[model samples]
Target chain A: MKTVYKKPECIGNKKPNSYCPGCMHSIVVRLVAEVLEELNVVNSSVMFAGVGCDGNGAFGYLDIDTVISPHGRALAVASAYKRCNPENVVFTYQGDGDLIAIGCAETMHAANRGENVTVIFVNNAQYGMTGGQMAPTTLAGMKTTTTPYGRDPKADGAPMHVCEILDTLDNPTFLARGTCTDPKNIIQTKKYIKQAFQNQLEGKGFSLGEIVSACPSNWGLSPLKSIDFINEKMLPEYPLGIVRDR
Target chain B: MEKVFMKGCEAVAEAAMRAGCRYYAGYPITPQNQVPEYISRKMPKLGGVFMQGESEVASINMIYGAAVGGTRSMITSSSCGLSLMSETIGWLISAELPVVIANFQRGGPGIGDIGPTQQDYFQATKAHSNGGGRMLVMSPGSLQEAIDAVFEAFEKANKYRTPVYIQLDGISGGMMESVMMPDAISDEEVAALKQKAKEEWAVGKMEGRERREIVGGADSGLPLQTLNQKLEAKYLEMEKNEVKYENYLMEDAEYVITAYGIGSRFARAAVNILREEGYKVGMIRPINIYPFPFEAYDAIDYSKVKGILSTEMSIPAQFIHDVQIAVKGRAPVYNYSTSGGVILDAVEIANHAREMMK
Candidate 1:
């Protein structure tokens, strides 16, 4: 058999991943690195890692230059970086809690202004880094530490569909929702990640790929069960597909 | 260039632009609104960015981002706005990013008024942030010094790889005075400076160099103690080299009045009044509030001094604490203050100093 599927050189191969097993953060980070390498922008790319398990993953895992933004402020930072250094490609890697909860205004404003940057938003339905408290994206009936009795739609509010929200914004050049569970879906997610980055590289303003991810340890399930949870429960609510493209 | 009459807020903003600041982000607030307004009109013409952030919180973070990207970035705000930015300021200090901020202070514990007050001295010098982060806090007393301070703030910020704060009261911010502008720094100069700094320290591709990991606070991968020790050592160095003050007319004086910024201006007037009346009085005006002119206090000739008087535009006199500590009981310290946006009365301070002499 011909040797194929070698790791991207942009990956920090010597270090062990700090993410829990079944977490999609490592997979998403690798895909981003691979896309940057493919586009020949790995050297020019800068990643703003927002505070979360995924945020911490960037420093040791991604060989590219990385800045860990204060929780929920990655987009604001990425916006500044892109405006200041227009030649460099900028992107933000953020989780559900970081992007939506404390950082809601930053997310909305960056998208509204059509800043030239990519946002790889990991929606894991809970605050994975801070030990799985309830998040803005936590499912309507899911049981989180804060929502131990299951999220009540009346008391709490519905799960936010990030792609749908960004679709309403006129300036965003591309918006897609993807999930990584089965092999086929993983490939599809990588494609969306590539396109979002291509948007930034092409000077297409404001692109975001919302990856419906899994937090196995936080969800109190085995790695396999988490995959099933994403497929059965998350797919119906989030509905993986492109919500906007121009 | 001939001196031009300019508002203190606008002068500081123009000075920052001349000093090669390419990015400015701020929100509209009292006593410092001219800063953002001036930048909004000027930055586009300068081929720079001026973003009115959603709030002071967002503005400081935007500066953080710009600073991390190795641009000369700054933010301007008043007391309440600065209070909102304190968290990001601490993070900037911890991350060791170079950024400049101007706090054109208004009267406040909360929304006091849109006028000059020295109420934020303690907040600026003592409790800037939660993690024991120290900023190079420079307080400018004149429009010329305000412009000069803005220029020097960037140099000090980039030199130390830390945030440098230019603390001006509303008087220095809102008052109009003639200022001689510095030579404009060319766009090419700014770009070259940013490129050089980026190559040396910014978060970017390693190329052939070792990977750079930018961190702040206790999270820079070093043990907590080691990181703190490093920060402490840096602060000690700042204290030694960065102590700045103006010893105004202290020679052969029987009484010394201590103040900073607008308060200093008033105190100087008070000193002049007492001197004309044949009472020996002088003023010690601290230009840098952080490594505050403690040595300037020690340099005072105690044999001729009757008592040290602290004059300020704050209710309970915040700057007096530092004066008392610096004097170390060699002379009693008296406080005369006018607060809540009420400008300090020079004659009242003069009378107080005369009484102390008696």
Candidate 2:
């Protein structure tokens, strides 16, 4: 019998990932691995893993050269890495808090400068590695550990739309948002990721794919329920599809 | 090798370029701004990268990235700007990337002032970052010395696989001096250095080698302890091999003065004045502020030496703590410091030494 699918060769099997059950990080990691392998650029690629649960398992799972950047500075690191090694493909995998909050300046400026790199922004609406702290992407009325009484629009402000923010920047070559809630969405998200990487390989400047991911452990919902929550809550605030494709 | 008159910041930038520093990322800050300005104009012409990061924080992280890419990278800033870079500096240390950082310090407990001060002594030498790690801090007193230190810093950083810091005050950064300019490393030589890094450890294509992972952030319990121990061993090795200092007129001296950076200039002047007045005074200037030349203090004759004076531009005397530690209570260590950008006076320092003798 011919095998239809197997793990991507770029993913190492030495250690099991530490992501929680039903965490979208595992799928996203596989998608990225598959993309890198498909492009045949796995050997020439360097991944900058931002500080979050999304990046915690990157080194263990991905069989590629990886640099775990200090929290929220992945874009800045990736920008310089790309500039220094222009022949190599550089990309960043970061969480909402790591990309949109503490590292806002780096993210914005890297985009503005049209750094030739890709950014895989995993927006799970809360800080997963540090438990359920409210992130910049956390929707108003959504509850997190920091927003225990639910995020009030007055106090917490509205959810941040990162793709929309980057849409205003003239330098960005690609900006797309997709989710990993279902098989259909996962495929679409992978397409966006592939495009982002392709853009980098083509020397197109500053491509980013905002992946609306799920964190069941932090959202206090069963893995199955978190999928439903994404459809009901997150998509309305963030929306899905390309905000810019220059 | 003709001596050329150049401003301190420009000279240091030229020195770094000559030292094979191919990547520079920094922000605009007083005194040190000239460093980035000079590089921005010259780096691209020589096939190097110069980035004006959005903030000091981003600039240092960019240096971290370039270092990871196996390029000679550097960042320069002043006191307040360096404060913004402390977190990334800790990350760079933990990751064990060899990068150079220069701080042209100004007065600061806050925004403070844009004038020369050595107030960052503790910050640079002791607690450079939150996590327990140390940089090989070099304190250069003049334009020539600063250029020399920049060259040595890159060599030492690559040798040890750790960050090397060049500590300069505003006086050293702003003043002009005649210095011999070093020849730039040829393109072939720079390429060879990068090739060696690719073979050993840099993050890049893993064609035939095992994939490299550069880990940063806190490890816990035994892992954290082990990491700390490893760092300590590296630091100890540096202490053994890299300690540098200058002992001026130390032989047969009854009184000794200790200073670093611009303060040493003042101390030297005071030493000359005191020697003319028949009061035997010498100076011990710490060139490597972290390894700190404790042996120099040990070599002092406390029996005949009445006192040791620590002179600097910080208000409450930060550098004195290291001086005392080096002296180990052999003699009373007194401080003659001027704060908030006030330059130390040779006359006042001489008077203080004379009073100690009396």
Candidate 3:
């Protein structure tokens, strides 16, 4: 009788997502699309997609002007876009490796310069696109394809806390960490993302929402077990909360 | 237009600004640092953006972002810095984004000294980036030519939806010369240009149009093949329509000297000295290094031409490869080169030509 719920108007080109079962990328993409539509900035937003599974994931489904940036360069690209088209909402959807490891300088500098843009950071704890290798966010003593025995602090170092790292900078207007392991966390994560986009619209400086995601195929666990792994193991290292909101 | 004495780097920056370049992101590299310094001071006054990126990698990607937004954007770097930007250059090529790049080239191989060298002739004209990407590379020999090339570069970049490179050297970048300054593009004209780009291909506020997607780097298999073929067609078109060269004292000559950039100045001087000595030497300088002025070489008369000498400020002669390809063994091609910041002397170049005649 009444039209209560439907797909996010921004998520056009109806095609099946290519993310693995239990992977959090699809949920995050939908949340972002819904936020863009809710803010009525879908036509004015440009998505700078990072290199990784997120590249294919975001570019494939998001019915918006998207630019698939070179590996580890999305933030730099987004910063330029925002500077040029200050009226348009610009954001980068990047993974742990793309944002934290290879692009550490760009990430830190973009945050420091306080570029008016949003960053959607997906932390899956391992390199998912390139066969589950060790990433900068890989937990200490976590076994991965490269670190089969376990990530050694001496060899691999501890996991990087992006929100904490960015917290030290005074330029960022919002910095929060949330997960998509369950409905409650998913809603919270969407709020963080929506706030990041709001910061851009308000001409507030750089905002980043780190979504602690799960990798079922890479973690060598079932989809259900991977959710448990994120809650029990990953949550302690990368605690969920707002690290900065200035 | 009043002629004013200006350094090469400053001239380039001013030329870009006049050509409607509203956004610039560059790192401070020797011989080209003046470009960013000048832009940083003047860009704000013009209501344009100028950012000194953390690295060349970030700066080029920033240009990528600005270009995608339909803004006129540019970046400048030297040898090692240009090498740092090669990755994103490849991405820009694949994405077919329009951006201007200037390489005030220095000695290379690895962190070579910050002095003039044509060592990057191959890097600029042959392999700007990986994946067989080609840019319309222009070699500007003088300050006036440098300004002209920057204006031409932006026009061609937007027309073809591809990156355009200005291949300069430290000598051209550091030298001071009197040049006529062109009138700046009004803010209204710049806005109209950007609007045209957005309506055509750039990404921003789709506004009742189909959403635009600019994808690069990860293409594989058949899609990559299709992209390569499309780019090849564009490059071929550029070759056909954009080939530019200067034939100096070439008619009724027995020996022809070939060069580009600052090396062309040296060759021109050598040609003058040879003509005074009654050796009948001339010069052919390529303006667009990628399209490469092969037709000029093909037009040379083998019957009267004794030899074609290719001279550049690089070891093992990088620019000569193209010269040889152009000559196609129609005449003897001799290469005389200097490397690692050494400037070629006109007398020595003339002596080399004289020896070829003997």
Best by DockQ: 3
Give the range of the ten consecutive residues with the poorest summed lDDT in model 3 chain B. B215-224
lDDT of 1 by residue, B1-358 (tens): 4588999889998899999999999999988889899999999899899998888878888998898879999999999998988888888988888899888888888988887788898889988878778989999889999888888899999888889998888888878998899888888999898888789988665578655556555553567688778778888999999999988888887888888887888888988898888987888998999988789989888877879899888887888999999999998899889888889888888888878887
Tell me, by lDDT, which candidate is best: 3
- Whichever of 1 and 3 has more DockQ, that candidate is 3
The two-chain DockQ for each candidate, comma-separated, is 0.65, 0.76, 0.78
Question: Candidate 1 — what's its lDDT?
Answer: 0.87
Q: Is candidate 2 or 3 superior in lDDT?
A: 3
TM-score of chain A of 1: 0.98
RMSD of 3: 1.4
lDDT scores in order: 0.87, 0.90, 0.91
Q: What TM-score, to 2 decimals, does candidate 2 have?
A: 0.98
Please give the RMSD of candidate 1 to the true structure: 1.4
CAPRI quality band, candidate 1: medium
Q: Given candidate 1, what's the lDDT at residue B275?
A: 86
Report residue B271 deviation for candidate 2 (angstroms).
Answer: 0.9
